[model samples]
Target: MYHIPNKYYYRLHQIRPRFKNDVENVLIYMATCLSNLSEMPSDKFAKAMNNAIKLFPGNANKKDKTINNWRTEISALFGLIETDSINQTSKPSNLAFKLSENQDLVEFFKYFLFYFQYPGGYLKPHEILDYINQGILFKPVSYLINVLQEGEKITEGRFYIDKAETTHCIFNDLRVTRQNNPRKPKNTAYLVIHNRKNNINYNWTGDVIRYAGDILDYMVIADLLVCHGNKFYLNNKNQEVIVSFIENEVIFLDYIPLYKKLNLNINDVKSLNDAWFYFVNSKLDQEIFKTDLYKYLGVDSTTYQDLVLDSINEFESKLEQGVEIKTKEIGDFGEGLVLGHEKMRIKRGKREDLLHLIQKIPTQFAVGYDIQSVEFDERKRYIEVKTTISNKKINFFSFHLTPNEWNTAESLKDRYYVYRLAISKINRELHLIQDPVGLYKSNKITMSPKDGADITFTEESSQKEKLLLWID
Candidate 1:
């Protein structure tokens, strides 16, 4: 019941010349019977074939011979083999014949079966091309359809081309084909371009613009061009523009519009915007985007490693004024300062084990708390530090607390404190915010949830109570 293309029959004849007469009918019947099934029993398969022959009367009389011949021909030609075994009753026994280990042939038959079952439906040519590229098909089925041929007449209607508006570019050969009814308003029209050139170095900006103009006269079109391992588009000015097509523009322009039209939240837009920026700029390649442990251990696996190593040789140059330190090193130094401050404040009797008890969980398990310190009264202080190399005067210190950390802060109540440290070339400043969850609940602070972290604001808080303590 499936429409088998003439090319499939031609190819089958070329592959198996002996079973040329039986291939088409037998394959179609086999594929249709096995379409909804992973494996079919011998008795059930025989019954299905008998029913299929009655439907197609040409092979009705040779039902038994045809079924036996097809089982052998299918295995030999299409790599579908039957497994058989002798039963204890000494009667003839057979197991289900499954598709062979040949993945390409199996995929082809699967596609062919689907197409056969669904007779009339729109199947995109690019989808077929994808199948070919993915090894589902042996060859380009689109090419065999004769649709991509140059100057091929596609129906009775003629596609008018304006001579005066045509660009003097050689690659701009546009062909428009209309389906069946030319006079109908909703008639489907396909825009096909025949690129017969070998040299791809030449600029096709003018050609693209001309094609767009030609297509626009008949229909609205969004064009995509793949060239030189990059995607390009013609802007409003007819200028060729290269963009991170798949990463940024395509998803942003196509998908985000639908999301916005549906009235989605601002968080969705913000997340998508961040993702697009990160993808376009290749942010993952930088050391800052690497694992926090990698940065904490000063593991430089980037191209900047050699430059940093060379800088180490120039000790005087390294010690020069205005020399910036890495963010991780600044963070570690801040933790050291906090540890020293805690060590000095703790009772003299417990001073020996103060550093050990500080925990420094970031290096160990990357837990919510960075350091566990003891107050003057011997009470535990759970401290999470946020460090920045930027000057406190010009930049506002921002800290991110994970959901786990937020829950920890809520559970610990007054014992939880966030230390925001700003390190400049000459001086270091630390600001502490204690009982942050209580502060937020009392409307003393504001926060935004981003990427599984609560981005709490310090300067943006509208609290009358100033809980910030300046650590000397």
Candidate 2:
């Protein structure tokens, strides 16, 4: 019989870390120290943990208990590394490699936090958390997310949780501690965490609050929650992640094979990775991942369409958020600025009446440029606008050019103009690039080896235009 594992936790040892950075510093240290070593011995693991403390800001001199918790609770529990007792060795997960030096902590958490859950093997080593009882386990993160996203409609969401309420939900909420509370709203299976045995140590109240708070802080760092004081507001910008919590939270894998993989000691990072690849009848589970949750979506659970549809929807939702919308807005604004500037330049010319020819092309057309305008010489100038919003001053400018756009620019040569707009609240400026393809061919502009085009300017690099009265 398995234990009722509805548990969330953090270190309760001497040095209690309330910040995500503390965890980051530890991981960063270990990733660097262990990068070359595939299998780390126990003694080396201990040494790494000790050095990790010194790496933390202010050098708090945390020792003994904190190091142990860092290894068992945070590191293994969070799936950063796995232990191999049979071989007397431990090794870092793929995540550690990604986070090996200068990784952005929040972006790391976005991928990492998916593995964070209450009832997983993370709590298996802790006596209090792994307290034995045979019952169906619940994932606290998903239940809480539903309360945050659709709370007003659901019974639990109807109640806003402050510190006291959060404590209540963790410790005393019967809906979580018991299987079926009459008070639990109809058709809501999420609130049921486990069946109450009346033997659970209620003295875990203080520890429960600390652990629950830590989980909330994790969500905040992952940009899923905006925590103001003790209350949390859903960060609507990351609805993609929230809906993810709604979607994938239900499928519980058969960790039995994983237990065998590590002799029931290591948390099994491989198992977590395997869970995502159910397409080939993954080693952990033989059947489908789509569960009763699919009923609400009106999908025929018997079909293969679920996986394909799920993927497409995820990509589409991600595109609708953050950079895509704002990029379009900035691109439009930048093109408008350059169009006005071009009109002003051509105003006094004999072909001033040719202003009608200067028009902004809709970006969706993908005609390889943004605007059709004229130089003072009335040359047919194909203007491609690349815009970025930076509130601070910087020396360099960078942007992405699609293959089609790059080809068109190369063909047009000097007849093509690139209006690189950097807009801020107080200033709007344009660095004009005529024949960017020629500049690159001659090694005049810096084209980065990475994702986008990078340009650093000198006197001969580009023509600068100062824009004014643009905001009003």
Candidate 3:
């Protein structure tokens, strides 16, 4: 019931000069003490005046005069007139007022002051009415108060319902759009989840669903099954089990069998509702969901499935050919992709000429860098590309860097950038870490020599030799 005076009161004090000090005190007193009361008695007002006098000793002897002055100032400034006779025996008459008469002041109080004091940035209709009544007692026959109360009730109800709906299934369409890049064209992908009844749609870069243990496991399994070309499934009775998709659409699947196929314990899952709740609240899971199988693939389920299979086949074929060939092919592919991205970005600044200057250093010699590009300001960018086909369940990525590469990055300083490419069967995500040596120095990335080498780069050339460093 503690009502904080909002900016409206301060602005009113600035504009209204007459009885400004007295009116301000009266208003503060009303907000602090009488915020929940319909009316305050004359004796109570006298006590408030006495308390004020005690706080400011200069007015201790003139309390009666100050109280009379406050009464007149309140009536003159705020139109809050005393209705009851000044007799101790009779009960005080209700001081009728209406905050709704000043729409701006009401909004200022509700949105600015009341919102800060209320829990969850929301106020119930009854609390709103109480706050309004604190400033002005609405008349018995007022239609405005009723309308405001009813409107607030409807709005609050709708807000809660919408919040509840978002905890279920949500469909997200992420369109990867790049300008001036011809190698990787723009494409759209659909992220569909089989949770509860709710179906929400979003167009953004981050995850739409929250992730928890059970929910993350479930979603990972779903993506794996979808990629493995297992869309339709039957229950123990051999009937098609329908699961919720987007907006009244259903997919055929029995999640129990899917769980069994993934070797996940069915007992860990409480219910689909519980999974949905966790999925709608996890930040890490949301990121995983966004990039898992949706960012670099097709919009439809069939196309997505086909892309997954094709990627798998291509990977298997390359591995069968030779390990060295597979590594070279993947390295070349990643460097080309990154080079194209760099060209697109540079072209935005009208520095397309830099594209020709950018060289693929990995194939040329034993240089630690991969591609070399120029910034808009004509500064050099030493880029090292590391590509991986592992899923995001592995929180950290480990890659090897030659001693020459570490020395180059250390010497280049800010010019060096590590572009980590996390490639899954259906999508690929790139994360850039600038100044790898600086990152290691700042403890952002851990670095250590591989094979337990004790060689130090700062030592003489005789003791220091090229050795690989394992970075995570």
Candidate 4:
């Protein structure tokens, strides 16, 4: 697929020593300009051209026609206008849909060389030879590899290099081959980037992402050629594949988030429950504990994925106790756990399952809905779900309560009610307490970490502890 233009190759070989840096500058400038095309402002593009012109130290002495033509071409490429009239002499004007030739890689590079060495100077033959060292070929090639690697859907994909003798079999234009020997090729090492991204479940821009395993299989063919000291011709079909590899590499280097921290953006999420974990744990960033988890979780603001992960971890730890509840009639006060081992195994679906439960809540008690689920209005009119550690004293901690349940006391007004469940080995007991805020209104009720005071409970005289009666 690679058509090495004789003219381009020849021109590159002819540059003299003095022109080398200038040519390189022009190439760099061209790259900068091309990179800007994706999101460049009209004003900035003009400035970019002006900056390129300033780079020529001896611009004042350059020939009139040559300089004029150079400026016209470059300016046109960036959508700028040239004025021959004396009236608007100094100011540059804007134009639409700049010249198309400037978009070509060869044109850009050629102009770059001219821009850098204008007054004189060019790359010497020996220097040009030195510049295209082995590593240089890999630089651009690596970009292509990176693009393909990034397109891989699996997080744990890998890459490998192989040198082997191989013969490529052509089948429907896709290069196919199998090798008889295990030995790799010489001088050519295949870099295999593998991932499950190309699996049936993943939808990808097909040519862009090659499973690392597939790449290795193709290498088997290439290995044969290298072993036999034969050069293999790459078909045109591989061109896009090559470009995608480079694109993915560049993208990964410049944009993707690092795995060490979850850059949780609360604005991206709709659920209050999802946001609550972030809001609460975001406070931990201020806590000067030895762990210093704020920085660890990548919380530039209060938003973080660590909060979600932490809540899930804590919830899972509690599952070992075999949550249970005693019947309210037996004076054993406890609410039933929504999910127990009897119904389903404790899996890594805490957040998702909880979200589902929230949605399943009767729409009559709902306040809002989004693409994924619904939420109860904060008006104390809705039931709040909470978890109790045991049925012993009916007093316990509620680690990850739904947002609606937590807010009824404040946002729901007096209608907020707490539905408490006592988890145990056998089953759970359910208890409902209405308007728990009344307890705090009279008694100097203080919320502590040991026992969260944020919850709303029933008045002392009310015997309405069985929550099932109110709903079922």
lDDT of 4 by residue, 58-93 (tens): 555666555444544443322233333223232232
lDDT of 2 by residue, 353-415 (tens): 777788777555688888898766656889898754332232334445667877788899998
User: What are the per-residue Cα lDDT tens digits for candidate 3 across 1-472?
Assistant: 1111342111000012233323223343333222223445656654653453343314457657665665444332232333243342211111212221111121111111111111110223343233223322111101111222233354443111111112121111011111111111111001122112234443222232221112222222233112123121111121111111111111112222332344343232222322222221222211112223223222356544543453465567656765343222345545655665676677766877766776666343667789898888888898987654332221123344667878888899988877766454444556676776777787566655642211111111111112111111
Q: In model 4, where is the ten-residue run with the lowest total lDDT? A: 165-174
Model-by-model lDDT, in order? 0.36, 0.51, 0.35, 0.28
Best by lDDT: 2
Evaluation by TM-score, superior candidate among 1 and 2: 2
Clashes of 3: 2
lDDT of 1 by residue, 1-472 (tens): 1122332221111123234334333443344333323335555655554564443425556657665655544433343323222221111111112111111111233222212100011122333222222222211111111221211244333222221112211112111111111211111112222121232132335333343233221111111111122222221121121122111211123222422244344343333322222222222122221113222223336523533443354334535744554444445645654554555455344555554565444443556777898765567899887654321121333456778788888899989988766543233556777878888888766655543344445554422122221132
The alpha-carbon deviation from the true structure for residue 59 of candidate 4, after best TM-score superposition, in angstroms, is 86
State how far residue 2 of model 3 sits from its true place (Å). 63
Better of 1 and 3 by TM-score: 3
Using lDDT, rank the candidates from best to worst: 2, 1, 3, 4
Q: What TM-score against the true fold does each predicted structure earn?
A: 0.29, 0.45, 0.30, 0.19
TM-score of 1: 0.29
Instruction: Please report how far candidate 4 places residue 274 from its true position, in Å.
Output: 33
Q: Judging by TM-score against the true structure, name the best candidate.
A: 2
* Model 1 residue 458 distance off true place after TM-score fit, in angstroms: 4.3
